[model samples]
Target: MNTQDRLIESTRELLWERGYIGTSPTAIQRRAKAGQGSMYHHFTGKPDLALAAIRRTAEEMRAKAEAQFSVPGTAVERVTAYLRRERDVLKGCPIGRLTQDPDVMADPVLRAPVDETLAWVRERLTSILAEGRERGELDVAMDPRATAATIFAVLQGGYVLARAADSVEPFDQAITGVLGLLTASTPATRE
Candidate 1:
């Protein structure tokens, strides 16, 4: 691969492993097998390289979600399916992980892709829920956006729990718990 391409891939991989704070230019250069001069020749600095990586990851995540989120199915069926989709619960959501990173969260440019990607995912799921409400599959009173955000939160939180417990059991339990809430109706569960 070209130096620029190699640099971007390296950043993506590094960010996944160490996040923004831990990924250094030297490390990136080493991973890419490019020199410091070569990296600087293509990008301004770590932030610039991170932006490219974040954007690439964002697009990839969106595409993956669209595959399942936009498919034909009931809201519960789709949301549940989307949640239950195979994931590296230990590695966690790459974009979601950025939310916990001090550096990535500090820079708007660096944070933009992560925020937008997650927002879009929630919105997509919300739209699907809205559709289900129209079909009477999901209660009309349900706040689509809030419900969507809650689902995403549970997912993000599940990653934290699973990582802490060093097992997928917590992740699975968390998902099952969230599904219980999502599937709860009669508007009484809120009480």
Candidate 2:
């Protein structure tokens, strides 16, 4: 890849592996195999490069979700597909992990992408749930906004729990628990 591309990609990897505080400009240069001069030439500094990387990561996450949501299925089925999508469970979420970093959370510029990505996920989930209720797949009384937020929170919490335990079992259980609750709320379950 070109120098600019290499720098952004390296930043993305470093940010995923190490938060903003952990990823130094020197480390990015070394990882990208580009000289300091080259990095500075293409980008103003670390923040600029990091923003680019974060934006890319956010877009990728959205695209991945969209792929599952766009598929032909009932709301619950499509959401189940999203929840069951293959992921590097042990590695944790690339974007969600950033929220734990003090530096990332402290800087509005650095945190915007993380915040926006999560909001997008919650909003998408809410819309899906609303559709489910409209179609009578879900109970009409179910609150889409509340349910979506819960789903998002549970997923993120699952990552933290799994990472803490050093096993994917907790994460899988969390998913199963949420899915079970969602299914139980569906009309099919009542019928």
RMSD of each: 2.9, 0.8
Report residue 13 deviation for candidate 1 (angstroms). Answer: 1.5
| Highest TM-score against the true fold, candidate | 2
- Which regions in candidate 1 have their CA more than 4 angstroms from the true location? 186-191
Per lDDT, the best of the predicted structures is: 2
lDDT of 1: 0.88
The residue pairs found clashing in candidate 2 are none
TM-score of structure candidate 1? 0.91
CA shift at 51, candidate 2, in angstroms? 0.6
- Give the alpha carbon lDDT tens digit for every residue of 127-163 in model 2: 9999999999999999999999998888889999999
List ranges where model 2 is wrong by over 4 Å: none
Q: What tens-digit string does per-residue lDDT give for candidate 1 at 1-191?
A: 89999999999999999988889999999999999999989998888999999999999888888877866777887888888989989998888888889999999989888889988988888898888777877777888888888898899899999999989999999999999988884244444
lDDT of 2: 0.93
